[model samples]
Target: MTNTALDQALQTLERATSTPELVKATQALCALNDLEAAKPLVKVLGFNNPAVAAVATQGLIQLGRDTIPILLVSLDARNYGARAWVVKVIAALRDPRGLDLLEHALEADIAPSVRRSATRGLADLELSEDAAHDQLVRCFEGLLKAVRDDEWVVRYAAAYGLEQRLNSAAVSAHLAEQGRAALNQLASDAEGVRVVQLRALKALQRLNAG
Candidate 1:
């Protein structure tokens, strides 16, 4: 598409006064997939419209690594909704630059949904062989702690994260064992939510099968 199309979309998004207008504009911007649209999409995240924010997220993810710097700096401390959506975008990108933010969100974010997304993001980070050792340890430690989160969703995500980390060929045997132990604990937590326990059990089974 042309820059003119992107410009029109951005104008529409900025001028939007209703949810439908916002969704339409955001969808248009997303379809453009222009790097110039990166900042605008990030701005849409704070619009407080889930439909619009979701579309903006898809647009940002479509922009890929070029959106990383924009996203990293765009974190709004006070806007939990925007932060949550931004975390999802960062997770989808799986860029190493997002690791710190993902870890911070998983460990300290007030939103369970954000924490859950962060858990998956941390687990799915694409670490190079040289950087995998320390970064993987960080991811594993964060995910292990996440297994005990107050929210069942976060715990469930943690179980899946641990399983993913364990499956990585880059994971050391020692780290793999620790991850398995964490999953085992989640699997047997009779007091925990049944869904979470089931997720943990499934993670364990997958690991054992591999």
Candidate 2:
């Protein structure tokens, strides 16, 4: 928010022509969470500039749980990198509050990459609660939509989430059929996706076996 910080973020954005600068600036911006402090970086997400958008999202990851709500609600941002980064930012925050947003993005996002990233991030965060469990179950049931999604990337991600989160039978019973459907769908996809799906399916089988 201060002129100095704003200048710094602006400079960071300017310097993002290289990958290392992009990573550093993003990490620096994460430390500055004030909306004013973050807005310059956030605005870059909306830029017609893809490099700016990419760097800002990387910086957004440094934004902690306190910053996730802003990113999550920006679900309507037209920039693919912006939407994709919101998922990445939430996942980077890795907080309980983000679970619901991650679930929402996973199910409702129109972008295949955003949906896939959110589902994988949600699975990575391991949110646990009766409420989280139920929400995850609902997320799993709908994964069939992604499982059958025209994009193999989304299908594989949905399958991976189901496999990772089936930690309890309470949730597992509901997902068993859907998980199977995802696996079958995975099989029909490209070899790269089929490989990921097989790994995800193998994870599910291991969990079920245990």
Best-matching candidate per lDDT: 1
User: TM-scores for all candidates?
Assistant: 0.93, 0.70
Best by TM-score: 1
lDDT of 2 by residue, 100-180 (tens): 777677667788878888767766674556577766665665565666566767767766766665654556654677676
lDDT of 2: 0.65
Model 1 per-residue lDDT at 57: 87
Q: Which 10 residues in a row give candidate 1 its minimum summed lDDT?
A: 183-192
Per-residue lDDT tens digits for candidate 1, residues 146-188, read: 9878999988889888888888787788888888888888889
Model 2, residue 4: distance off in Å is 3.1
Model 2 deviation from the true structure expressed as Cα RMSD, one decimal place:
4.2
Each model's number of backbone clashes? 0, 2
**Which portions of model 1 miss their true places by more than 4 Å?**
1-3
Per-candidate Cα RMSD to the true structure, in Å, reads: 1.6, 4.2
Candidate 2, residue 154: the lDDT equals 75
Write out the backbone clash pairs for model 1.
Answer: none
